[model samples]
Target: MMLDKVVVSDILSRSCVVTDLVAGNKVEVIEYLSQLLFAENIISDKALFIRDVLAREELGPTGFDNQVAIPHGKSPAVRETRMAVAQLRHPVDWETEDEVAVRLVILFAVRNADSGIGHIKVLASVSVALGDDEIVEQLMQAESREALYRLIVNNTGL
Candidate 1:
């Protein structure tokens, strides 16, 4: 399935701000997700969940590009596979080969490691969507969460 189809407005953050790459990589993922769970009161101890997700991040960096990162983990902290997309207010140092800061972070949480294939497809779709400069620009300038969702759906045909 395409990311735009799976990514909802409730899971999209438009004004995330980050100063450093490491914090950006971790906070962008955990904060957006925590907000989602908080809104639903689905999970308690957001810090603990963030720590677990960061532990998964230590296994490898999720910074896929200068502009994007996809951090994910398989843990019970997530009841299902949730995908949260964030557009940072400013670029954060992502420590990539391109040396460009990351403007977007897509955090994925899956129920099982065996279900990674589905996550891979979502990541692939996100990569394709980010390839177009116009799409990227539109996403960056998206004024509202719903606008961002529509932009993604339009680009990914979801």
Candidate 2:
């Protein structure tokens, strides 16, 4: 798929957003998100998907500075390429590159078959969108799921 084909709103759902996610740690956060996605039918298997994400986490840090995290897993369990947002009630300790607390979790559920090219492109789009400090600030401060959705729509372009 092309960059133009990657619509932020297409992957993101207002229904899947959680503004006040209360998780004590990263593992709980991962499990919570995995369950949420699976419940929404975005993923076929919650347990397997969680294992995939944890395995990916073992490879390297998905958490970045400024309390942001983009955790992902590519598995056959993924039924859809979807993005779920969770703004934590409080920042939690996460294994981050800059070693900062994580307050914003963006979970990416990806199909294993398309892991090579499509995965990279979609992820890069989000990365580039997040590169803007203003957008990041907006995402961090968004009060509602609608606000979060609109921020992504504007920043990620048409």
Best by TM-score: 2
Off by over 4 Å in 1: 1-29, 41-45, 113-119
Error of 1 at 55 (Å): 1.9
lDDT of each: 0.60, 0.83
| Candidate number achieving the greatest lDDT relative to the actual structure | 2
Candidate 2 local lDDT, 123-158, one digit each (tens): 788888776778888888888878887877678764
Worst 10 residues of 1 by lDDT: 13-22
Off by over 4 Å in 2: 1-4, 116-119
TM-score of model 1 vs. true structure: 0.69
TM-scores for all predictions: 0.69, 0.90
